[model samples]
Target chain A: MAIQQFEHGKMTLEQFEILLDTLGTNFDSWPKMKQAEARNLAQTLDGKRLFRGAQKLEMLMMALQSTPQSTSQSVPESSSESPLVNSAVTPCDTQKEAFLEKLADIPRRYQQNSAHLTVCNRMTLFVTQALAVNSDGSRLFSPQRLASQAAAFAAVLAVGILVGITPEETPTGSGEIDLSETWFVASSDFELGE
Target chain B: MPNRDKADDTILVARVCAGDSDAFRLLVIRHGARFRMLAMRFTFDQALAEDVVQEAFISLWLKAGKFDGAKASFTTWFHRIVINKCLDYKRKRQFSALPDGYDRADPAVGPEVKLAADGASNRLKTVLSALSERQKTAVILSYYSGLSNQEAAEVMQMNIKAYESLLVRSRAKMRKMLMAEKDDLFAAFA
Candidate 1:
């Protein structure tokens, strides 16, 4: 009883099935020793059915890869409109080049395409999130966002002046009206009444 | 004979690891055709397949120093590299007229391979695209690329059992889909 159960190894039917998912219908690809076990399993009624099913599928896959030359050449039987083209192209002949002519430019093309993509994305941002126009025709930028961004920017400039500008400019007596502080007032005035 | 070739590859891979450009070129030329054909399974377009092969070798050349002879053979390592590159290209771009993109001679290529990549692989690819990513990869590496189950496992970075499990499921799915396609075709004939 134990031998009967253990014939398939510790690999349960479920596990065996999971194994089948990756290996396809071929037992040859199985480990050299296990190939015998796999073939044995394939001989069972269910296994045979599965094998037939997979064979039909495999045949379809093969049909997709290389249609039988006879079938393609059958003319009346074959649906292909141009037998001329079919005869002209053989798999090995076409595969000879291996398509390496465009090799050197791949990186360059990727670089250019990626740059183009980035620019397109940046432009897309302006169209969607950045430039999202509201019901009215005015710019989509909300006052709150503008105000928040302005505040953050002003804080950065303030830190820069006290830490960088003041140290250099203060030591030289070139205070220069502290334009960092006054520019906001001028900008606010410029936006007034509009 | 295969063993000797394998040994030769080991030498070539080592030379490449040592920064020998000529060795790297030889490796490219040696594996280029196979890589291109493998890539063609992923991208039915010959031009795109070549692009995938080109990127694979370029990546291999850049990463030659990382090749660990003890862990995997050169062929397995390089196959993984090429498979990943093909997947990357597929992810980035949408492939149209696949498995059959070679219906006409691409002006870019000379007359040799122009006619077809196995007579319009698109029918299979369209159906194959329905599979999960791992299933698709398994079928391509195992069925299309002709990597043995064990080699395919290495390429997928999965254990033998796990890879087999995946292949089984993939084959089952393929059977179901292909059967459906056949029935559809028959019905059309009717």
Candidate 2:
């Protein structure tokens, strides 16, 4: 019908091309009414050239879209053949099985993965188990325990403070130096290089 | 026939949700090659296509519980997932260079024919790669993947009219770009 509209000059060439784009080069693929119109249009002088050009473009586009195997298959054959038609055929059995096998292994692998703990999960489980096994769960936070921990923390802090305030004794013998003496070199004594 | 396929897919997905690996495997066997071809059409590299399909299947497994039969058929939903994976792959590798001889010539082909085919394919790919991402997707989904416009629009999450517009613009752009090549193609036929 769009081609009919085009024949009547009611549709533009661009609009007619959209019908070609959608319905494709094969007249059989177009609507029954439109197929007659399209075929009639093709019989016209200009329409003949347009349809031929469109079919050629379709073939070229198919050549661009086809799998590597199909491209080679069409080369020695007629150019009028559409590579799209050839590539649309299902893949061979061996190739199909290879792709299927790759997918078939996924669920089993996923099952195995979820069944086995990850490293982080294992670490968490180990920590929980160790805590449950070694400690009386209810008494882990008793007042006496908290008091003991606090006292230990205070003693450690005190020791750290004492260490910080206490000066180190100077090394004796050849490494000994007088703390009161100053060893200084003036900047003026050095030469400034260009 | 599609309704029967959809019903079977629904049952398989339900079984998958219930922890049936066999059902999952069956679903994989049924749809794997088709989806692989779809991914290959998008990615153009077999290895990358396999990776895309694998990742999509893995997502399907984890998200099977999320599929609502009321919303979309299993194939349409899965097509969305596969297309998204391809789009994401394209985005991540956007800055990387395409490998040498990406459209490799057949060794069995004559040198002259090989050279011509290779040259034409390379030029076509150059023109194709220059298309905007959505235009490329529209062309691939409509022309290459064999999806009906409705199904492709659903996968693309676009209205039918919008999808058709995209297809029209895509064909127009490709036609303009290949005007010179069109002459050669016609001459060959003549």
Best by lDDT: 2
Candidate 1 Cα outliers beyond 4 Å, as residue runs = A1-52, A64-95, A98-194, B97-101, B105-120, B184-190
lDDT of 2: 0.66
| lDDT tens digits by residue: candidate 2, B1-190 | 5665675677677656656677778777667767877776677666787889998888767656667666887888898888889889988875255533354544545565555555555565666787998998888788666679999998889999899888877877776566545466444323
> What ranges in model 2 sit over 4 Å off?
A1-18, A26-53, A61-96, A112-194, B95-124, B185-190
* Retained true contacts (fraction), each candidate: 0.19, 0.24
Candidate 1 DockQ vs. native: 0.10
Docking class for model 2 is incorrect
Query: At residue B166, what lDDT does model 1 achieve?
Result: 78
How well does candidate 2 score on lDDT at residue A59?
71
Docking class of 1: incorrect
**Global lDDT of each candidate:** 0.59, 0.66
Give the best candidate by TM-score: 2
Worst 10 residues of 1 chain A by lDDT: A70-79
DockQ of 2: 0.13
Candidate 2 chain A has its poorest 10 consecutive residues by lDDT at A70-79
